[model samples]
Target chain A: MAPQSPSSARAALFDVDGTLVDSNYLHVRAWQRAFREIGHDVDAWRVHRAIGLDSSLLLESLLGDDADSLGDRAKDLHMTYYLGARDSMRPLAGARELVRELHGRGVQVVLATSASEEELDVLREVLSVDSCIAHTTSAADVDRAKPDPGVIRAAMDRSSTSGETAVMVGDAVWDAEAASRAGVTFVGLLSGGISRAELEAAGAEAVFEDAQDLLDRLDSSPLARLLSL
Target chain B: MAPQSPSSARAALFDVDGTLVDSNYLHVRAWQRAFREIGHDVDAWRVHRAIGLDSSLLLESLLGDDADSLGDRAKDLHMTYYLGARDSMRPLAGARELVRELHGRGVQVVLATSASEEELDVLREVLSVDSCIAHTTSAADVDRAKPDPGVIRAAMDRSSTSGETAVMVGDAVWDAEAASRAGVTFVGLLSGGISRAELEAAGAEAVFEDAQDLLDRLDSSPLARLLSL
Candidate 1:
């Protein structure tokens, strides 16, 4: 593998769950079941929109005042349910190819996700492009997750890249907000069940249908513009 | 219950799955599992977008050329998976109240959905507003489902309402299209994870966050205009 050029290198930071793996709905289901187990009957669509946030933030956003008392048990139940269904998780189309292509182009590719290290390992396995991942940042590395900029900043710092030369690809509004806060360009994908309009409202500069669509349009995409820069 | 005055009576038609009940993601999961069971790996987001269409149309839309061979088995598997998860389905906030309010105002309330009879029974149970629902059209009542206008028209017919006096509330683009085709006004909800822009582009005159938001703003919504008319 060729070393990234220090002076003019660009980086591609990605959110793993919905952005690369077809697991957002599974996460939604897990959270729904977890909430139900803890005597809270949260809606699935509500949980779907909360998938990319840090687990604690997710529980708070969904449970509100109840989160103070029920968050820990809900989080534990979520992990159990999520892991039980992990075998069905698959990579989004062109996920591995997109990562490989970015790495092959000498761009620093980092997995920037709010998933725990254990969960990240499973996601990486599903994505099956770890060799192309130059660096990664998990929930453990940050005190706050998206829409906090901490995770994005951590990924950029680990990749030794600046925001001007980095672009974040993600499937949630939280990812767009995090990228915006971190001064990185945001590219959104609709594969996470988030709408393009919502993504744009959250500051996405460009939007694609999914990983395959992004890969197909890479030459004309924001990533391509970054590569040219 | 008082009979609706034909001279000024209006109707409110509703799409069941994502519009009233929080089951779109569950339907996405069911479709995903069903496809996998039949040796096809359809993405959940893809299934999510196809939720409001008829089963055959959904299979065709997702599987294309292979749908001819695998559609029936996939449909059966989908029913089994969906039924298994039906217990978790819950009505969106204010779903029943919205129906009851409309019905109490002397407006005809119709449950217009592409769901099968059995599935509709489960959804109706979840919403628990059957008394307010004067009529309903399941898949058995229509040869073709939404995006084809058959189901919406069936609901209108059953309610003894004309397009000019009725409004269709839904959470998917297909519902917008079907309402447009049926010549009924379309109101959109964001509860299904579809974007407002997409719904508006599909011909929704107004959009709300969910059933709760719509109910909260009923006096200022398109439904209010129909009430006055």
Candidate 2:
């Protein structure tokens, strides 16, 4: 059941991959590069749908259970390559500023992503606003990644925010699905490469170009009233 | 990564709804009763696939985006009737004895269920084996209830078990899908009215007629050593 709203939310959950940073394409590129090196010809787009999934599940979704044929050798290959690509990380336009804005308004901001710890470290460095982050969740902390809401619950638990007092913003269908399943208001961001239709279909109640758009239109969104900004 | 294992596992995860208990048909019957009450005509088999899903999502899956118009109301009505029907709950033939056997052998047993807390109480009362259960999960704790691994993870976490240390047993394709997604070994139980091919297609590594059959042929099954008997 959806939690009853308190007229004001205490936090805003943000998806780190494509929603806060312009890295969904990079992840696709990295997975494609890694899979190719391991002798698998996987479609990058297909890899994208399964992006926010946990590592093994993502690989399984991409290469099937038989990818086990390659074993640990394949896992190391993907991690090393994906980590190497981290140098290309960049925050989506306005992500940093909006995060700061929310923090100023006393809204606890959390980073919930399906990215592994190694990936989040790079993101943390790139985003460079350590004080603004109230909490963060990665695949390491959750057994089932996005579209499951475990990370969201973990993040909320860390921030001490009740599900009723929180909202999630993300750019993928998985994010929308997770938010919907978790019974939170879902705000879709287009910067992550997922279409608005896909996000809406998954259950986003509102849409924006990215964090910047959200910040600019906060007054008209649930966020505006939520944080009284 | 596949959960790190200790060469061999001694614990197993069993799904509740259709696997150890013949409740899928009852769930379909209740849903049929509720859907019709709310003025929607949904096929029973289609509703059966949704058995493991959270009631609202199950309705949405069947009734689509606009399902709220009738689905929400129907869900309450369905549960209203199903809740009353709990007195009819019965354990599949070998379920009780298998739990007792597993308890005696010192093999850990856990329930990975999508049942509501209300339903779980009924099941516990009906199954009458409280001391043997090491862990249990309900829809309240997870987002993607099934066809996702959150419930399994919650159970594993509560049981202090890892994915590699666990083997999921269940009756439906969704249970197999969740266990597969979690990278756990899956054993299918036919008591839920699902077929062997369907279970295997969803990713079960083996199939058993019921808990007693599994107990009767424990030596033939890979999980035999993990059983308490």
Q: Count the backbone clashes (under 3 Å) in each candidate.
A: 0, 3
- DockQ, per-model, please? 0.74, 0.01
Per-residue lDDT over A1-229 for candidate 2, one digit per residue giving the tens place of the 0 to 100 score? 1113433338889998877776765566566567767777554335656677666667677788756776356667767876776655667778899999888787888897767788788998889988898888887788888778788888777766765678898888888888877778889987765556667778888989778889999878877655652
Q: Is the docking of candidate 1 incorrect, acceptable, medium or high quality?
A: medium
Record all residue pairs in model 2 with backbone atoms less than 3 Å apart, i.e. clashing: B94-B212, B102-B228, B105-B228
Instruction: State the lDDT of candidate 1 residue by residue for A20-74, as single tens digits.
Output: 9999989988888989888888877788888888777888889999999999999
Model 1 / residue A188 / CA error / Å: 1.2
Displacement of the residue B33 alpha carbon in candidate 1, Å:
0.5
Which lDDT values do the candidates have, in the order given?
0.88, 0.74
Candidate 1 wrongly placed segments (more than 4 Å):
A226-229
- Which tens-of-lDDT digit does each residue in B1-229 have in candidate 1? 4354666767899998888999888889888888998888888889999988877889998999999999999989888999998778889888888988888877788899868889888998888877888888888888888899998889888877788888999999999999999999999998887878999999999999899899999999989966676
